[model samples]
Structures are given as C-alpha cells and as structure tokens.
Target chain A: MRLAQLSERSGVSAATIKYYLREGLLPPGRQVNATTAEYDEEHLRRLRLVRAMIQVGRIPVATVREVLGHVDDDSLGRTIRVGAALWALPQVPEPDEDDAYVRAAHREADALLDTLGWENARQLTTISPAYRRLVVALAAFRRLGYDWDAELLVTRARLMHQAAVADLDFLETQPSEEEKVEAAVASAVLVEPMLQALHRLAQEEESARRYGFE
Target chain B: MRLAQLSERSGVSAATIKYYLREGLLPPGRQVNATTAEYDEEHLRRLRLVRAMIQVGRIPVATVREVLGHVDDDSLGRTIRVGAALWALPQVPEPDEDDAYVRAAHREADALLDTLGWENARQLTTISPAYRRLVVALAAFRRLGYDWDAELLVTRARLMHQAAVADLDFLETQPSEEEKVEAAVASAVLVEPMLQALHRLAQEEESARRYGFE
Candidate 1:
C-alpha cells in the first residue's frame, strides 16, 4: 500500500504519518522510487501502535520511543516486555517523608504487599510506580482521617484483580504479537479514564437512587 | 489551641498553616494576645481538609479555593455542592472533530450516556469532567482499534457502581457534617490512586498466575 492508503486506512493524516516516520515513531516503508515508498501490513500495524501511544496513551514522544524500545527488545520474556513497558511509564514525584502519616503509610504498604505476596512485583526492575503511588495514597488517606485498613485494601485489590484479568483476557484474543502488545498498552492507558468515569457516574446513580433523584 | 498546638496536632508546620491563613485556605484564628492567636477544633478540621487537598489530592491552591468555596457555600444543595466540585475538576482537552474517530466517539459517548440514562448527570451545572474524560478516552480507544461496545461499558459501570456505593457507605459513617464533607472529598481524591494501583497490581498478579510466575 501507499502512504495515502495507510493514512486513509488508519484515519491519521499524511503529514502526521510523515512526521512519525521522521521521528522514528514509525519505520520507513520499502523504497519503490525516489518519492514513493511502499508500506505493508507490518508497517500499518506499527503505525497503529504509534498512534495509540501518542494520541490515546498521551505518552511523550521520547517516552513512547523508550516504551517501544522495551516492546521491540526480544531478549526480555513476554511478561517482562509488557510489564517493563508499564514500569517505564511516568510516575509521581516521591512524597515527603517528614510527615508521620507518610512514614506510617510505608509500613502499612509493606504489610499489605506482604499479605498479597507481591514483593517481587514491587521490585520488578525498580519499584513499581503503582506501589509508590499506593503508599502515597494510603498516607494521604490516613492524614485525612480515613484510614483504609488492610482488610479494605485487600478487598479492593481483589476486585481490581478480576477486572484486570478480564481486560487481559481481551488482549489475549489479538491475532499478532504487535497487536497484542499494542492492545495491552492501549487497554492499560485508555481504560483508566473509562473506569474513573464509571466510578463517578456510578456515584451519581447511587446518589440518585438514595435521594429520589432517579 | 495556639499555633504551636495546632502545628503539633495537625503535623502541618506553623509556617504553612499561617500561609494557609494568609491565603484564605484557612479562616482567621481569634487573637488572644498581641503576638498569639487561639485556634479551635474548627481550625484543626479545616487544616486537615486543606492539607488533604494540597498534599494528597494534589489540587492546586487556586482550584482548592474554588472547590472549598463550593463546599462552604450554604446556598447549594449537598448533591450539587459535591457534584459541582467533581464537575469543576480539570478535564481533557476536547478531541479534534476533524478526525472521524473522535466524531464517532462523541456519537458513541452520547449513545452510551443514553443507554445509562446519564444525560442529566453530564449536564449537572455543566458537562461533568468525568463525562468529558469518558468521551476523550472512548475516542482514543477507537483510534487504537478497540471499540468499547455498550454492553462492555455498562458491565464496567456496574462494577464501579458497587465500589462507589461501598465507599459512600463509609463516608456516611462520619459523625459530623464538615468531617463527612472532608472525608467525601478525600476519599474521592485519594481512593483513585489506590484503585489505579490495585488495578496495576492485579494485572501483575494475573499475568503471574497465567504464566506460572506466582
């Protein structure tokens, strides 16, 4: 296929696709002539992945390059390839440990991770941003006078475990390696706001249910 | 309580608490002497709220003022007070209408809202930030070649509905109005990271289970 066909098929603009090529986000096509290059299904697949990372995931161009580097590195196992990309995404700045609440949270987080036997998951490469974020969030809750006991935290984790497995089940159905990786990345990034929106909407629905607004 | 006492009790420094007083994030304390002021439980409560907004929720000072203004207003009903703050939280920039994918997302979002009977929730004062986020995310997913059909979206919503209701039940257990409001805000803000972290951890666990890593 030609560039125009790829652009039309992908619903991305020609100039944008050209820019991606220049930026190495998308690989150059087979050179058929001086001004024209031929693209194949593989190029199309990669272009879609690039588009997902940039437009949907909102990953910085440089970060996308780094994440894609992880995706393309075959020396890593499949789980690490996916997990490493997730690990490489942006993270929150470390919270100040001067506060007692934050210090307590670290202890509580260690207990919770121990309860779940997730210590390996925490140190998979460096520490998972999720663990750091969890600790920060737990401390914040404690500071706000609403302590989330380990029982509550574990319950929430179990609920999310099912949702995550359900989502991964969907990704496993993708037909190609690139497609699976693209789907996993896109699902992880794109599904977040959807989940958040659902929570808010559900809250609204519940409020209405309780207050006769429905 | 004096400034020093307030600092000791809240774990917020006297200097920072004074800054909040000057910035109107906290109300003025009673001047008990030429060089000292007397704070009360109200001040302590407000201090916790302000700290939660800044430290845990990461709300900007100006936005916290706006949200707190809504919270302090007696004219608005409780639902709108909380709902309005949720509505006022930041939003994703509107997607490009020139792209067919985004246009399709707008249509799909509308259809999903209709399916859920949430049009009123979308326009509570103005379009809810969550609603706007949902649309942007939907467009992004469509661009990534994953159309979230209405059935799937509804299923996700039901799951979140249960979780939101459970959290609200905890909020209802608070014994005072201000504390209830503070806990509501903090839970809504702080719990998101916990939920997100849980999702990621769950994903890790599921991957381990499937691939024999656990």
Candidate 2:
C-alpha cells in the first residue's frame, strides 16, 4: 500500500507517518518511485503499537523510541529492565502546578517503601526525579498547614506501590506474550479503581463486622 | 503586607499569587497603600485549598474557580454538583513515564464501568480521578485486544470500588474528622496494594488449600 493507503488503514495521518519515518521510529517503506513509498502490514502493526504506547501508554516520544528499540533488540534482560523502568514513572499532575508536589509525593513514597524493606528497589529509581519534584511542591502545602505527618497516608502509598509491584510480577508470569501484554494493560487500567473501591468496601465490611450495632 | 511578605508566609511565589488574583481564583487582599496589598489568614486558607484542589484532587484552574465559588456559597447541593463536575475531568498524567503509562491504562476503565452497570455509580465518583482513570484505560486496552471483556474488568472494578465505598461509609459513621480524613487517606493509599496483595495471597492460599500447590 502507498502512504495514503497506509494512513487510511492505520487511522494515522500521513504527516505523522512521515514524521515517524523521519524520527526513525518507523522504518522507511519500500520505495516504488521518487514520488511514492509503499508500506506493508508490518508498518500498520508498528503504527498501532506506537499509537498504543503514545496515546494509551502516554509514553514520551524519547522513551517510546528507547522502548521500541529495546523491544526490537530482543535482549531479554534489557527488555525486562526497560519495561520495569518504563512502568515506574510517577503519575503527572493536571497542570499549571510546579513539579515540587509530585516530587514530595514520590519522596514520601520512597521513604515509605524503604520503611517497608522492599527489595530490588532500584527498579523505582527512574521515577525518583519526578516524584521528588512533586514532593518539594507538596512541601509548600505542608508548610501552609496541611498534615504531612499522616502515617496512614504514608503507609497507604507504600502498600499501594507494593501491591502494584506484586500485580506486575504476577502479570509478568503469564506464559504467553499476548496474555502478558493483555494482563499488563488490563492491570494498569483496573488496579486504581479496584484499589479505591476495595478500600471503600473493605472498610465498610470490616467496620460492620467489627462494630455493627446489631 | 506586600507581595514579598505574602509570598514568604504562603510559600507560594508572588508570580502565582498574582496569577491567582488576576484570574479571580484568589480574592484581592486588603490594600494597605498604593503600592502594597495586605493579605491575611483567610487568603492563606484559600490559597491552601486551591493548592489542594490542584495538587491533591487534580482539578483544573477554571473548575477550581467554580468549586471555590460553590464553597463560598455554602450551598451543599450546588457544591455536590460542582464536586461531581470537577471529578469528571481526566487525571492529568504524571511527568514520569511509568505513571503516565499506568494512567493511559485507564482508557479501558470507562467501558468496564459501563459493562459492570456502574455508570453513574455514586460511590466511585467520590474518590480520586486517578483511580477512575486507571480503571477505564485498562478497559480500553482489553477492548482493543484479547478475550478479556469489559464484564470481567468491570466486575473487578466494582468489587474494588464497593469495598472502598463501604469503608468510607464505615468511617463516616464515626464522629471524629481526624478519623474520617485518616480513613479516607488510608483508603486512598493502601486499598490498591492491599487488594492486589490480598488477591495474590488468596489465590496462592486457595490453590495450596485445595490442590497442594505452592
């Protein structure tokens, strides 16, 4: 298929396709002529994956390039490290806020993680910078009078990160690549609300169990 | 009494305070003279609240303004609507790559919520947008590939959200604001990890209990 056809098939614009090609994020298609380039099924597949990573994974272009490179290299060790690193970045705030808040949160999270004695903690180092930025910003709030010493908050963050690691570990154990990817995507999507909801429900159930005035 | 003094006391820069004032997000403090504005404790409280909405709750500036208006009105009914509206915005992705990826997973969570008959589910809405976003993103990925449908994902999300909600209700039954906030924060932080760990442990324990598998 030509560039136009590829764009139509893949739901990506021809401009973007060219940009990807220029950036070497996508390999050039077979040249039919000086004026034309022909693409194939692989290009379509690659485009979808790229979209997934950018639109769905929210990976930065630079990181996506590195990850795609790592995946292509097929180095199992590097793949694992890259994957773990990719998954370890802290969540971004909405906007117009300073980086300090996320830095503070990540710092608090790290301290909590340390307190929990989590092993192989270097897997999270990639996220430390962003987290530290948040923490610093949040420190301002603390100075302004919000409670920073809430042990429960610290414990909760530690536990949540620990749970994420465990879930990722389990997801990684899936034998099939397809299933692993599915589980990876699904786990990311499902875990937060699940956690939020579980806390709500569990507290209710536990409360009722413990203190219901029957 | 001046911008510098306010900045020092608030830990918010003069630039930001100026932005807030211009946007009407922050009310003008008492003007002491032609060159000086005197901010008081109320400005500090409002500023902290604004930071909380942005940093903690992840609300945007425009919505934050609306919410503050409602807060000032003290019309609980209108405030609830404002809260709900504010909750509907997407959780901004963190700068960290991993956090962004996790957030992207939430695309699927919307479908899962619908599949689980959880559309307009009140309790889930009350918690963090980050949680909700993650659930939906995961659902989107599942929809794109694999046999995993929204039904399964929704069930998990609902089960989790319900747990958290029940816990909230339980905490609310108590009299102390401290306990309530502690419970809310605890639920926010620990619920995900707890559920993830509990599920993993339960699966392992169940297998062992029933089939002699470790």
Candidate 3:
C-alpha cells in the first residue's frame, strides 16, 4: 500500500507518515517509483507499536526511536537491551514551569535546610525534581506559620519514594518479555490517574472516619 | 513593612507578587497613601499559602481564590464550605499532542473493548482522560499481535485505585485534624512518586519469583 493507504488504514495522516519515515520512527518502504513507495502489513503493525511507546509509555521521540530499533528486531537480546535502556532512562520529574516559582522555592528551601540535623540534612538534592517542587511549596507553607517541621517532611518523603519504587516492581511482573512490556506500558500510562483516584479515595475514607460520619 | 520588604522576606519576586495581588491570589492591604499600601505578617503568610496552592497543589488561580475564600476564613461554616468546594472543582488535564502512535493505540483499545463486553465502549469518554490515552496505546499493542487482553488491564487498574483509597483511610487513623491535614497534604503531593516506587518494587519481586532467580 501507498502512504495514503497506510494513513487511511492506521488513522494517521499521510504527511505524518512521511515525517515518521523521515525521523526514523518508521521504516522506509519499498521504492515502487521515484515518487512512490509501497508499505506492507508489518508497517501497519509497527505503526501501532510506535504509538504504544509514545502515548502509553510517554516516551520522547528520540528515546522511542532507540527502543523501536531494539523492539522491532524482537530478538531476545534486543528485548533485554530495550528493557535495560528503559531502565537507564531517568525517572521523569514533574511538569515544566517558569522560574518565578522555582526561584522562590529555592530560597525557602534554604530556610528548611537550616532546620535539619546532619543525618537528616545529608544531600537535599537527593529528592527528585518533582519532590523538589513540593519542597518549595512546603517552604511557602512554612512561612504561613503552620509550624510543620522539616524532619517530619523529609522522613515522610523518603518513605514515600521508597514506596513508589516498591509499587513499580509490583506492577512490572509478567511471565514473558512481551507481558513485561505490556505491563510496563500499562503501568506508566495508568499511574497518574491511579494516584489521583487513590488520593481521593484515601482522603474521603479518612475524612469519614475522623468525622465519625462513616 | 512595604512591598519590597515582603518580597525579600518571601523570596517571591516583587513582580510576581504584584501579579499575585492583581490576580487576587493575595489579599488586599491597607492603603497608606495615594501611591503606597501597607501589608503585614498576614499578607506575607497568605502569599506563601498562594504559592503552596499554585506550585504544590497545582491548583489554578480561580480555583484557589474560591478555595481560599472558605479555607482560612475564621468562620467554621466557611472553612467547611471551602473544603467542600475544593473537592468539587473539575480536574484540569495535562495536554498532549496527537500523533500516529496515538492513532494505533485507539484501534487496539476498540478491539479490547469488544472483547471485554463493555457495551458502552463510549463510556471511556467519561473515564479519566488518562485511561482514554492508555487505551489508545494499548490498541497499538494489539496491532502488534500481543497476547494481552482488556480483562487484566481493567482489573489491575480497578485494584490499584482501590488500594489508594485504602491507604488514605489508613492515614486517617491519625489522632488530630492537624495530623490528618498534614498527612493528606503530604500524600497528595508525594503519592505519585510513592506509587511509582511501589510499582517498581512489586514488579521486581514478582519477576524474581516467577523466574526462580531470587
């Protein structure tokens, strides 16, 4: 099939098909003429797999390209390699933002730093960037005279990060490499909503219990 | 003190502070003269609270304004009203670009829907948008002839959501409202990382057991 046909079948635009081909996100088709190319069933399949990595895994194009190179090959070694590569990728931090809040966060962080003992203080940067953002918010909260202490926050944060690691390990289990990939993809994509839902459920249940309403 | 002193003390830049004032994210101060206004410790504290809400809670200004109207008011009824309002605000979703891979995922999702006996497949629209995004990716995986089905995915998702609720209830066993709020805020800000960590840990343990390598 031509690019147009592939686009129609896959629900992707022809221009995007070309872009994917050019970006090496998709393989080149068999050249049928100077201006035309022929794609096959495999191309359609590959297209879907690509979507899975990007949309579900939330991977960037460059990283997806590397993973695709390994996954499309489907050799045991390559699959292992792809998994290793996925592991090597740094855990993503939170969303991007302007420096206004970021700067304020840094300063307030210094005050919290003042309150910590050496054992607790060790390396403040050990927290993930996402957590760093939270620390900043907490710093602001501190200014409000809430009287929440730094030690408790740090300890809770460390415990939470540990728990998250545990969850990831649990979610990734599957009998086969294919299953691992499937679970991994699902884990990555479903995680944020799971967190949100969990927060609501936990808060509601806690509130009910505390208020003696339920 | 004046704006400059408050700005220095808060570490939030004067310009951003001005913006916060204009946006009503910060409360108004006593007008000292035609060109000056005097803000006190309460103003300083409120600025930090606003930062925490925006930067930590990731709540928008409008929502924050409504929440604040009730949150810090001395009246008990108002605080209760604000808490209720906070729960009712609509979640604003993070945006992502549509791409070829997303198209593939949608197709896989459609097939999964068929298999799962989900009669109102269109009900996906009412689910969290994240779930819809995942369906798109999962659809792409199906196109690759993977053995995964919708049953496992849905089951796991439901379970995880349930577990999160359970965790919140567990936290509510704390003795005081202050403790509850502290735990809730910490959980809200830190739970995602904790969940991610937990997923990783569980998957690792399961893999070790399945492979008999531990």
- Model number with the top lDDT: 1
Q: How close is every model to the real structure, measured as TM-score?
A: 0.88, 0.57, 0.53
- Candidate 3: which stretches are off by over 4 Å? A1-22, A26-49, A56-60, A67-175, A178-182, A212-214, B1-5, B30-41, B56-60, B70-214
Which pairs in model 1 have colliding backbones? none
Q: Which regions of candidate 1 deviate over 4 angstroms?
A: A94-103, A114-126, A143-148, B94-103, B113-126, B148-150
The sequence of per-residue lDDT tens digits that candidate 1 reaches over residues B137-169 is 787777765554557676667678778777777
The per-residue C-alpha lDDT of model 3 at residue A86 equals 44
| TM-score of every candidate's chain A | 0.88, 0.52, 0.45
lDDT of 3 by residue, A108-209 (tens): 455544443322222324433333545444434554445544444444333343444444455455556554553454344444444444334333433443
Clash count list over all predictions: 0, 58, 34
Where does candidate 1 chain A have its weakest 10-residue lDDT segment? A119-128
Give one digit per residue, the lDDT tens place, for model 2 in A1-214. 9999988877679999898898887879999889888898767766766666666566677766775664454334433433443334234333233456555555654665466554234243444332333344445445555553445344444444445445555655667554454354334433444454434333433333443412
Query: Candidate 2's error at A141, in angstroms?
Result: 4.8
Candidate maximizing DockQ:
1
Task: Give one digit per residue, the lDDT tens place, for model 1 in A43-88.
Answer: 7777877787777667899998887888777776667777778877
Each prediction's whole-model lDDT (CA): 0.75, 0.51, 0.52
